[model samples]
Target: MDARRGWLRFIGRRLNPLTLAAARRGSAPFTIVRHRGRRSGTIYETPIIVARRGPDFAAELTYGQSVQWYRNIRAAGGRCELARGDEGWQIESVESLPVAEGLAAYGPPRSWVLRLLRRHEFLLLRVEGSGGDASD
Candidate 1:
């Protein structure tokens, strides 16, 4: 068990709404994703950092493949709508990034994203679900 991972989990789980809101709206790329709960039938909205590869929009999940959000997308095999402020694009949930590649794609180990990779290799999820669910 990685002590660092545990600490990060603790922090994220305990993050206040204010900070989460700031992170979601700050200069860093932000997107609001709608996904179903793993065990529950209700859908939830979560804001995540947006990583762009050309026209494609991707997200780097800090919980790796085991993260709740990642699993939610996989479980429902549902579409994802990535929204930035008032603008957004629809994309499918197909591309998944593994550890080594995710780390490399995220770049140097000095950035916060690098730190996310150090604890949990991000999920390189792609978006392309056209005419999918974008409405609340």
Candidate 2:
């Protein structure tokens, strides 16, 4: 597990810059997630894949729930900003979803791939003005 984490860290450092650049250019499947660090309060922009689910958004927890971004988001009261394509949205709330429900939102291909990869953890992000239910 340590080796895998090391490898991922090495790769992420190299790939994140490029991914961030592409994501800013309105690229498909990539969104720029802007979050503030829980302790340092430093703002961070991370590139991730987000899928639309009704007026909300869904994302696979590819690196699990312990990732810094996820922690930061939670620490910030589940509020963040997501930039996708030429559009941007202020995420009002975020909640963990049951695997089955999350998978259903993803539909085919992505859901299948995620299932195959054993990525069962997912999050639902409700846009601020989307009128989506933000309650637990």
Measured over all alpha carbons after superposition, the RMSD of each candidate to the real structure, in angstroms, is 6.2, 1.8
- List model 1 lDDT by residue over 1-136, tens digit each: 6997887677566753544465456535456676778799687666676566445554566545676666787777745566655566665754555555555555664345566546554554555633323220
Candidate 2 Cα deviation (angstroms), residue 17: 1.2
The C-alpha stretches of model 2 lying farther than 4 A from their native spots are 134-136
Q: How high is the lDDT of residue 23 in model 2?
A: 89
Score candidate 2 by TM-score against the native: 0.91
In candidate 2, what are the lDDT values of residues 43-74, reduced to their tens digit? 99999888888888998888888888999999
TM-score, every prediction: 0.62, 0.91
TM-score of 1: 0.62
